[model samples]
Target: MNEAIMEKVSADPFAKLLGIQIIEIEEGKAIVSLNIKENMLNFHGAVNGGVIFSLADVAFAIASNSYGQTAVGIHVTINYMKAGMFKDTLTATAEEVSKNPKLGLYRMTIRNQDGELLATADGMVYRKKEQFA
Candidate 1:
């Protein structure tokens, strides 16, 4: 991992606030994790959907920008498949599906520590001309 790139990803305030950990990053993939806390629960006691979405989004962002180019999410769709419980550790893995000069597509999957799938997402990003790393 490049220290500069890792530093940039780790410096995101929302990720920090949610205790998200950037586990891995490559040219077109990323893995992120989050330990669900009681405070992160929804009214029904399951982890909030937004939290799961954010985790997937972080992985998507890291993967899309892993090329050192500035990539911004243009479209994303997620489907929740399972409820996440408090105290559970969830992992999100993002993989690049396709890309062109100015755009990229990624797929992200969220799973529990036990390997049960929780959610899946498809994401698209618009790559900017500027490089961040």
Candidate 2:
């Protein structure tokens, strides 16, 4: 199941475009990493909040869909706590907070290589009856 989930996430074009890498994934958790690049920086010369949010979203998507059922994000809220610098490797981890037959809630955290918290997010997804192909 993990292998299949990894394969599915590996093919995500948006994730690939942002250089997000899947570090780990299980039934209701996932870890993804990204290396800060020049293009990812904002006018303030810090990694853009969108980039951090994208990393967290990737982790959330992976964890929510880890069950092999199609899950689509319905809502998400993120809080940025720190800035990421160039060359910094950021990792985002998502874990299931709660779930039922049709909905799932996940909590995600982004941290730098030194384990400093960068951002946190909560996401909810609606599970579909269809399974991944």
C-alpha lDDT values of all predictions: 0.95, 0.95
Candidate 2, pairs of clashing residues: none
Worst 10 residues of 2 by lDDT: 1-10
TM-scores of all predicted structures: 0.97, 0.97
Off by over 4 Å in 2: none
Worst 10 contiguous positions by lDDT, candidate 1: 1-10
**Angstrom error at residue 64, model 2:** 0.3
Candidate 2 Cα deviation (angstroms), residue 91: 0.2
lDDT per residue, candidate 1, 1-133, as tens digits? 6777777887989999999998999999999999999999999999999999999999999999888889999999999999999999999999999999999999999999999999999999999999878
